[model samples]
Target: MAANENKEYSHKFDECPTCDGDLQYQNEADAECLNCGEVFYHEIRANRHLLWDYDELGWMRGVVSRA
Candidate 1:
């Protein structure tokens, strides 16, 4: 994975997208919801800036081309 791509843009999720609550990020690949306890995973593809691709649990929400 191109780790540098992530450094190009610094991002912090303000609230949990699933429950609209607080979020505690374990790392770059993990996001845990403080309210619902839902864990979401994301990937930083090669040469792509997709901040998030799904809502939760495989829900096809958005391909979001950029951060």
Candidate 2:
């Protein structure tokens, strides 16, 4: 019996390699962009689920307070 430790998988997303624009999720864990016609590949290393989901107002307030 062998213990497996490899869990991380490489993830590829259709992202713009020039401007780093928002990569839209296509369907099969892949993304494509029609803006700049750029392609990219990524890997899933760490996944951090957001707990405190905030809106624009909350984010702005947070920035102002920090400043």
Candidate 3:
């Protein structure tokens, strides 16, 4: 471990606030604006680790299909 390795970065955004379009969930941890080319990712926690935000609407489809 290095002394300079201790840092926490935060990206408190998961959607394109500029584009007024529905966010298309690319997977479990990624999303993109269908209208614009803007991209967004999961938020970084206090440990500077990225944790994914899941789409509830998208997950519903998977559950229904598996049934």
- The most accurate candidate by lDDT is 1
Scored by Cα lDDT, where does model 1 land? 0.60
Write one digit per residue (lDDT tens) for candidate 3, span 1-67. 3443422232233345555666675654456777775555543334443433324454312110000
How does model 3 fare in lDDT? 0.43
Clashes of 3: 0
- lDDT (C-alpha, whole model) for all candidates: 0.60, 0.34, 0.43
Every model: Cα RMSD to truth: 4.3, 12.7, 11.3
Clashing pairs in 2: 11-42, 11-43, 14-31
Residue 33 Cα positional deviation in candidate 3, in Å, after optimal superposition: 0.2
lDDT-based ranking: 1, 3, 2
lDDT per residue for candidate 2 within 3-64, as digits (tens), equals: 32122222333335445565665443334456754333332324521111123453311110
lDDT of 1 by residue, 1-67 (tens): 4786567435656476656888677887666778988665555556443545455467746643344
Model 2, which residues run further than 4 Å from truth? Answer: 1-17, 46-67
* Lowest lDDT 10-residue stretch of candidate 3: 58-67
TM-scores of all models? 0.53, 0.30, 0.40
**Shift of residue 44 alpha carbon in model 1, Å:** 2.4
After superposition of all CA atoms, the RMSD between model 3 and the true structure is 11.3
